[model samples]
Each structure stands twice: as structure tokens, then as C-alpha cells.
Target: MYIGRFAPSPTGPLHFGSLLAALASFLDARHHQGKWLLRIEDIDPPRSVPAAIHRIPETLSAFGLEWDGEISHQSNHHLRYETALHQLQENQCCYYCTCSRKMVAQRHAGVGYDRFCRTQQHTGGAVRFISSNAELIWHDAIQGKRTHAPASIEDFLLRRRDALWAYHLAVVVDDAAAGITHVVRGYDLIDETAKQILLQQALHYQTPSYAHIPIVTTTNGQKLSKQNLAKPLDLSCVSEQIAAALAFLGHPLPESLLRAAPQAQLRWATEHWSMERIPKRAAMAWPGV
Candidate 1:
């Protein structure tokens, strides 16, 4: 069976950009007659808002984006992340780094880690995965063949000095463990795909197919995100929101369907969803935002 997931970090309530990802993932899964799973990416407790754990699902439900099986939370899967880290450690692909962000910035003026801690043996600090390969590349379903520059391909951290599992490590581990066959997400994460692929290779996990939808940005060209203070979607206008999301994906719905119920709108979208119609760009300006 084709298994797909919509993993949202509970840092804030769902916004327009997040709805685009959720709607795309949900429609893709339904179009393929596959199971759509929901996972709360609450690994970073400090950054997570307690209310979002409830609001996210409620918002998805309001938008008629129902998920299959029990919702998985990353916070409950510490053992799995630890096991994956240990596997990387056993493979000699992971190293302990004592360098802080400021330390690395001061040493390397360019992008990514400077590999200063690659030689130095540290006991307890951040754990970084060594990129043995010179080039990291992958084929995105939407953007086609993509390659990462050497500057972007560095020894990324698996675990932070703060003891939190890095997003790359946890995401790769969770996707592999949950048998996710397809990943439909926003394009802002396109750069991280290479790092995730590298981690999958090191951990000997099957790399799932990836389709990155264009991210919704503000008129100022800033990506819509919780950090950017993007407003949460108004559930009262669920149908309109769904229609707008579909329109943003290059599948504009008829005016009649814009006022329909959430389920009806999603039904029309799923039946007519076309991966080819999705824009290949990384970002698009959200109208009237």
C-alpha cells in the first residue's frame, strides 16, 4: 500500500502555507487510494506550543483532512531516535562535536559546518553525521533532478548539544519506521531533502519518493511560517480556504465549489488532483496576504 504522511510541528496553529501542504498530501494519498497518516513533530519541546497539539488536528478536521490510524507523536519515540543515532555511531558515520553555532561561524565564514570538530574527539556535545560522499543529489517529483552544493552538504547534526534530536535525524527515522512511501511537503524544505537522503543512505533505510509543493510567501517575499507570524486559518471559512489552496497548487476550482462544505470541496479536489499541474517553483506570493 502507498503510505503518505503529513507531519506538522506543533510550534503554532495551522496557517495557509501549512494548509497547502496538508491538502496536497491528503489529496495525493486519496487519489492513489493510499493511507494518509498524521504525525505531530513535537520533538522540540521548547519550541512547541501546548495548544497546537489540539488545534492542528482540529484545524485539519475542519478542512476535511482526515488521517488514518493513530496519530504518532515524535516525543513518544525517543528510543527509536536513540537507536538510529546508535546505528550511525556504530557505522562510524557519526561524530561528537563540541563546537557551538558561534564557534563554527567564527571559524567558517561560508555556509554549513567547517569540519573543525571532525578531527577533535569530544565526549558529550552535538553529534554530527559525516558526509562521506562528495556530492548529494536526489530526484524531486516536482522539481526533477536536484543536486546539493558542497557548501550545503556538511556534517549535519543528529543530536543537538541541548540533547534534542535534530530534525533531520528524527524525520528520517520516523519516515522509514512508519513505512512512508511518498512525502508531499512545502518547497522550503527542499534544501533539507539532500541531508535527509544522506541520513537514509547511512542508516540503510529506503528513501521515499518526494514531491515538494511551492511554498506560500507574503507580498514582501517572506515565506509564510509561524516564525514569520503568519495568521492561523479561520475555520469558519474552511471551504474558501480549501479552494484557495487548490488554486495556489494550480488547480483553480469553480466559484460554485468555493461555497460548498469542506468535505465536498475536498472530494472534488481529490478526484481532480494532478501532480503535473503543481508549480515547480520554490515559492509563490499568496494573494491578498
Candidate 2:
């Protein structure tokens, strides 16, 4: 069974860009007769907006992107992340780092973490995953072959200094646990795919196939996100929103179907979904729908 997921961080209300990813994932899963699961990535409480959790599902429902089974919340899986971290520690793939952001920035000249703490023994600060694997190459279903040099791959954090589980670590653990076979998300995550694959290899987990659709960016080139203050999709205009999303994905719909109800629009999208039609670029200007 092909298990796909759309794990959204509950930082704000779902916007056009989020809907694009969600709709694409939902259509791909439905087209393949696979199960599409929803996971709330609320592990970082400080960045999470409590009410956004309730609003995300409501928005998904409004768009008729119903998910399979019950939703999984990352906030409830602290022990799971910890266990995974411990496993990495046991495998000697991780080390505790005491370097602060300021120290790392000054040392690396703002490129990324300089691995200054990789050799130094530290009591408690942050846990960084060492990318020792030589084969840092993977073929994305959309973007084609991707290769990353081990030297350029930073020793990313598994646990933040603030005690929050890092997104990279938690995402890998949850995806493996849920048996996710495909990852359909924005192209901005294409770079992170290699790191996630490295973590999966460290944990002896299967790397899921990846298809990164083009991200919707503003006219000014900023990716549409809560941080960018993108406007939320209006549920009252669900049909138009679905049509616009389909068009953005290069699946323009007929005028008749464009005015159909949410379920009808989703049904049409599911049947017509094609990976070849999706843009291969990393980001595209917002369609102004």
C-alpha cells in the first residue's frame, strides 16, 4: 500500500500555498488508490498557534481533502522523537554540541553550522547528526537526480538548544513510523530531502520516494507562507480556490467544473492528476487567483 502524508505545521491558518501542497498530495494518493494521512507538526509549541490546529483541518475539510484515519500530532510524540534520538546516539551517529547560534555564525561567516562542536564533548546544548554516509545522492520523482557532497552537508541539529525536537529529526521518525512511501511536498524541501535520506539510512529505515512540486511564491519571489503573512483561503469560495489550485499545478479545468462544489472539484482533480503536468521548477510566481 502506498502511504502518503501532508504534515502541516500548525503555525497559522492554511493559505493558498499550503492548499496547493495538500491538494497535490491528496490527488496523488487518491489517484494511486493510496492512503493519505494528516499529521500536525506542532512539536515546537512556541512557534505554534494553538487555534491553528483546529483551523487547519477545518480548512482541509472545506476544500474536501479528507485524510485517512485519525490525525497524528507531533506534540504527543515527544518520547518517540527522544527514542529516535537515543538510537542515533547509540549508533554513534550523533553528538552533543554546545555551540550557540552566535558562535556558529561568527565562526562559519553565516554560511551554516561549522561543526565546531563535533569533536568537543559537551554536557547539554544541542544534538547534531553527523552525515558520515558517502552516497548522498537520490533521484526525486519530479526534479530528477540530486547529488550532495558530504562535506557540504552540515551536521544538522536533532534537538534544539531550547529543548524542542528539531524538524529534521521528528519528520524522519514520524514518516518512518507511519510507513510513508511517498512524499509530495513543495520544492523548497528538495534540499532537505538528502538530509532526511541520510537520517533514514542511519536509522535503517526505507527512504520514501519524493516528488517536489513548485512552490507558490509572491510576485516579489517570497514563498507564500504564514511568515510572509499570506492571506488565508476563503472557504466560501472553495470551488474557485480548488480550480485556481488545479490551474496553478498546470491542470486547468473546464469552466463548468470550475464552478462545481468542493467534492466535485476534488473528484475531477483526483482523476486528472498527473505528475508530468506539474512544474519542475523550485518556485513560481503566485497565479493571482
Give candidate 1 misplaced runs (Cα > 4 Å).
150-152
Q: Using lDDT as the measure, which candidate wins?
A: 1
Q: In candidate 1, what residue range of length 10 has the lowest lDDT sum?
A: 129-138
Q: Write the per-residue lDDT of candidate 1 for residues 144-240, one digit (tens) a residue.
A: 9997766568889999998999999999999999999999999989988888988999999999999999999998898888998898999887888
**lDDT per model vs. reference:** 0.91, 0.90
User: Which lDDT value does model 1 have at 176?
Assistant: 95
TM-score, cand. 2 vs. native: 0.97
Looking at model 2, the pairs that clash are none
